[model samples]
Target: MSERTDPRVVVLTVLLQLAQEARQADTLDAFAFVAANSLKRLVPFRNAALWTDRPARSGVSAVSGVAEIDPDSPAMIWLDALCRHLAEDTSTTGPMGVRPENIPPELEPQWTEWGGPFALWLPLRHPSRQVVLGGVWIIRDTAFNGAELALLERLGEALGETLSRHLRIGTTRSAILAALTRRRLAIAAAIFLLALFPVRLSVTAPAEIAARDPMVLAAPRDGVVARFFVQPNQMVKAGDKLFELDDVDVRNRHELAIRDLAIARTDHKRANQAAFADPQSSAELSILANRIERAQAEEIYSRELLARSEVVAEKNGLVIFTDPADWLGKPVKTGERIALLSDPEKVEVLAWLASTDAIVLRSGAAVRMFLNTAPLSPLKASLESASYEAQMSPAGVLSYRLKASLAEDEPPPRIGLHGSARVYADNVPLIAWILRKPLATLRQLVGL
Candidate 1:
């Protein structure tokens, strides 16, 4: 029921039977050992070879039996193309025979252009039935006839089956390893999530608020701010004597003016009363009247200077900064700042806004500010004023000044606390909120 067995057929069949058993070996090393021995015994070719496709490897054969198959050899052109084509087509029988139509255009030229006189291709079929496992290529210079072709077919089939089996085992082994790794990672993540893992956030450039108190205590006279009776942070009421300057010279001048005025007044009264009785008293009366006027003017000026010596607080507030204690004896000019006081309760929140946001910020827009130290608690406020012009920040970013008054009563804010606020605007999608920057960058680059 079949072609009669010739001596060559008998020997080839027996060797192939043994080779199939040896090729059936599980390990690639074992399969290779069995295949080489079988090929040498069955065929008269000077050299026998086996090839396989390896992940992430390119050019020439990744796994090869022949040492001459250099990794970078140009001879790999045919093998590479054959392997790629076979890797995609899993249904076809490898090395049984291939029509010119069945061969891909990419490999058609290589079949003729390759240096080898004969070449064999076998698809390493996958056992999972998902896709082609890969392909193997056997090349030689001497062409074979029908009998030799048959032997090569059997060899290719046996090799393909062996590769398929090993590949399945390899796949199973890889899947197990991957599953174990995933389980370990999941456990680690769970443990980390349960512990409330703390994330440390640091800010190199923190937000700053600028503020100032309009109430300032100034020196009332051209005298040193002597005897500073109050220190910074001390509370004082309106009209409280803050400090007193030395008034010894002014007091002495005032006393001298008073004595001169007394003598002039006495002479003027006697001269005026006697003026009607004697004509000579008229001249004396005029001189004494002039002297009394000069004395009164001097006395008034001296009295004003003495009154200015006792400086008093203008309003109720805590003093922020006062003149240096050592500067008590030093002379000071009029209108010089001696101390600063501010009502801590009348506080306003100062914030920086980008020029773009500043344009949209109205005078009554709502704002919620959070101090860096108390991030969880927010201070409600409303925009009171904003500067029209923008200023360049120290880091060269352009921003505009914004001011707001606290809407609720809270503890007095520290002068230099870092803070930020959300000036409510229109809401957007969550995806847009997260990927806005990256998407904007891509759009800019691609001109989309």
Candidate 2:
């Protein structure tokens, strides 16, 4: 009633018996160690490599009948391609065997150089043959015969079920809990220490680097900008000609005023001579003197207008704005903003703290700034002032203005550079730190 067994058949039967001991897989190492070592005894191969399909833990490999296997070696590449093809293309009719010349052109050169064995790619599929859990690759000097391939394929179904147990995420939860039980005291102590820890609470907001003392440069008169002596961000000293206006109209008025003043003086002198000749002409003499005085005032006013056309810088600083094209040939009314001159040495940070996050902020709080351009190195600072009321930000949100002074030892940031700011508040319990904002809002909302 029973079939007789050959030595090879007896070895395979023993190998299958040893592998079936895996009741429910818990780890890849235990399952792989049993299967790979047992397969090496039954199969006539120089090496065997087994791997999983998951990306997170795929790098580790278990080998049998060989001292080592390099991941970068040609054998590994061929194994990778075989597994991928087996998993992706189910159209392959049945278990396939590869001879030496059957390898792809790209992989042939590397395979020949290694002088390795003829590799076999075996797919371990589910019992129903619906899914593949993983794969096995064995190597030998010659191509495996049909009877040997059939035996390997028959063993794949049982191996797939056992391997799938280890691939599951929840299968090891009971094992993890049991291990944690042995160290329960240590874990409990760590949780207790973390709860009692007091830490400073901090809030981050949008911020910008601004000049401490910014001077407003404006149009001196209602005229077009003729020329700019310096470009934007150029350093200028007091009395430096910043720009010139169209002075043709003012120059013409000055010339007319000068000619009128000379004529008025001559008339006044002739009237004085006539007044001495006749007493009745004294009234005419008074009128001519008044005309001469009026002409003198007109001439002075015209001269002032000509001087005002050429605007000059009043302080030493850098002019901040766009290029020359924005100013040149642009008509501006008197007192219209031209640009801002900022002192490079005197600079401060202006942070827009959102109203929701500004409740915890106080004067003299520790502040840290990271300019967008230099994000790695944060600039140390201290809060100087905060607005009593909220104002609309450029981004259309109501926020409070906060001023901060940079550290004395640190170099000043460039004016108008925008970045982020973090303000550290008072220390509190870990629980309070998490619930601080929500509690404040609750009190304000319902007076709780």
Candidate 3:
């Protein structure tokens, strides 16, 4: 045989080569796999496993000669339990030989079924910090000598340094992944429970305080509005002068009719006197009488028009209209709406609900109106009726007209006060309520 090389030199050569290989590993998992399988080059072993203490409990991360690990497998499960039990023993800080008698009674059967006659536990620790990062298990039929154990310890330290370097590079990511893995089940359970929580399905819409079953005041004459006796939102009593039309045309007609009546009466009086003297004059009296009757009818009609020129409130209520400037000198047609006489105490909530947000509202769905003037104090109301068809609202949006009655116990709001309203429908799951709008939009886009 050729001259034998010194065993010390051989061991040193192998240790250096393994250290270089560990350093070259690109990831922590790669380094762990190399550490578990490559130790056989210096110390012979039939099987090997690597366990990490990164998590709360130690877990077997890699197995020698196995490309993928099935965590549920009996062997892996047993090994994981064994690693967790062994990690709890703080006294075993260094390489220790594990024998059949060394294992606890609870794990004795599993150890006997899967372990070899001799097993060596090599704790991987930071060289400078001396903190345990992980461990390696070597199983074989024969006992591990002192020299081999010493070499394995050096190898463990080298591998641990390499692992720590990779860990430091991805410390944030590793910590996040470890935490997520540990609490994944709890997080999933919490989310599932939250999705099933019951919530009231509701929608928001623009609202206004409106008159409920109030009298509408329309223009009674085809003439220019000369003056307004009552301002917008002014309280007025029955027979109060609300507005007046320009009386110039009606007064002119009245004067003409009065003059014509005077002329016809004068002519009639002369014919009646002449009829007693001349028979032919009596025929003229009949014609003159007819002319007087026609003039009387014209005078009466003009007098009625003069009376209608002045508008009056029919009932005692608040008068709601636009700015007085908009109506002054503005000519209006007969029967055209000009103002509203509303009872302030009998007010209602008028909401313009968007068609997209419409739901199956019950007869008495709850409605909360947040008025612009007093948003802090919302007015409670109950839905009374909703329009069957959507119409253009005053703001020019297509919306459904919803009328709700304000709570009788609460004082009614002033007419025409604007606000926002929240209309609540039937109860549904929280997930459904959250996803309602998104799903509606998706359906519209997809035309499904």
Candidate 4:
């Protein structure tokens, strides 16, 4: 017989052609159509359906000779259930004939109505994983013979490999579309622009209102403080008594000086009276006169000490000091600060910038002071000076001393009012401004 007339040659040619069509199909939907309708060329089937394990698409994807699939339809629903039941049989890996007697009792009733006298189940498996990806269901009026089942088994592998490839490509394409959506792209652009935007480089430090060029009042001598003549923040005039030291010792010294001076004068008078009569007495008069002069000097010095026991203000201004009780009976050394005489209107901001937060600043960089008492009313100032080297602050931190002059138009806050200062330097990119501290810490840790 001629090759064209040979039945075996015809079957082999159709199988090869179907396999090529499956591989050449551009999409999963197209391949599903081919799998459901085109398989009849090798084995005749009255109806055919395709099913998959994908959760979002777990149902009959296509039906023989139907361009569109209505999943809600009774036939489609029943077919989906039947395919799922058949796919669970792990023991039947090859093409097998299915009949009512072979299926569970629950599916027997539906088989009589929806299925034909014989059905063929072909499971699609992943080429490498050997896991079931899905299956194809075919029903016909005639029973499938052993030769037909064997031919279908080979075709099942080709279909399974093609279906698996399409599923993987679909998943990758879905992921790419999801990640490149317009909303996500817009958000990324916004963040990138924000990082590049310019902002004034700034830092916050501890600050307070301080007197400008105020006169400091310290202890005049080494003594215990007896009393304070003026209260803290009280306005005072020049020569007003500010405070006093213990004067008991000074008063006693003055009294003794006076007594010694009196004795010296008496001795000098006696020597002068005797000097008029004898030469020896004349020599004694010179020595006695010198003694009188020395005694007079001592008396004058003691009187001055007594007068200075009470300290007075040198200028007319406000007296700024701590609680009066703190200084009462408190011992002080010479030149130790006791109080400050400051003008109420003249004030400046004193900020302690930590060494870690220090930045390059000019003479007139902007500074804003937010007081603890009145934070809403921030006082504006311009940097006047910064210490050349860092020093230990009262809070036990090494920091640079910064002095900023308050704006002329703004009223100065009360002296000694504590606050925070925000100092602004040259403009820089927002990203650099935000990462400045973290980058500095990283550099310190890595030594790079």
Top candidate by lDDT:
4
Which digits, one per residue and each the tens of the lDDT, describe model 2 over residues 283-338?
88888889989999999999998989987878889888778898788889999988
Model 1, position 394: C-alpha lDDT score? 54
Cα-based TM-score, every candidate? 0.48, 0.52, 0.59, 0.64
Off by over 4 Å in 1: 1-30, 34-48, 51-137, 142-161, 167-214, 221-223, 244-309, 326-334, 348-404, 407-409, 413-448
Residue-pair clash count for candidate 1: 0
- What residue pairs clash in candidate 2, if any at all? none
Q: For model 4, how does the per-residue alpha-carbon lDDT over 44-148 read when each residue is reduced to its tens digit? A: 999998898774678887889999989998878878887888888867778877888877787778887888888888998766433677899998988888889
> How far out, in Å, is residue 226 in model 2?
2.6
Global local distance difference test of model 2: 0.76
Local distance difference test, per candidate?
0.65, 0.76, 0.86, 0.88
Off by over 4 Å in 3: 1-182, 262-294
On TM-score, the candidate that comes out on top is 4
* Residue 100, model 2: Cα distance from true site in angstroms: 82
- Which digits, one per residue and each the tens of the lDDT, describe model 1 over residues 1-448? 8978799768776766865675558786566555544565666544344555544453333333553445455556655665566566656654534444567786676556552455555555444444344454555656666776666666665566566565454566457757888999999888656544443211112244433554777777787655777776678999887788788887898999999899899999999999998999987877898999999999999999999888777888766663456567878788887766777566667776754333355677777778888989987877787777888755476877667777766666865567777665434444444455577678779999
RMSD of each: 10.3, 16.1, 14.5, 11.7
Question: Which is superior by lDDT, 1 or 2?
Answer: 2
Rank candidates, lDDT, best first: 4, 3, 2, 1
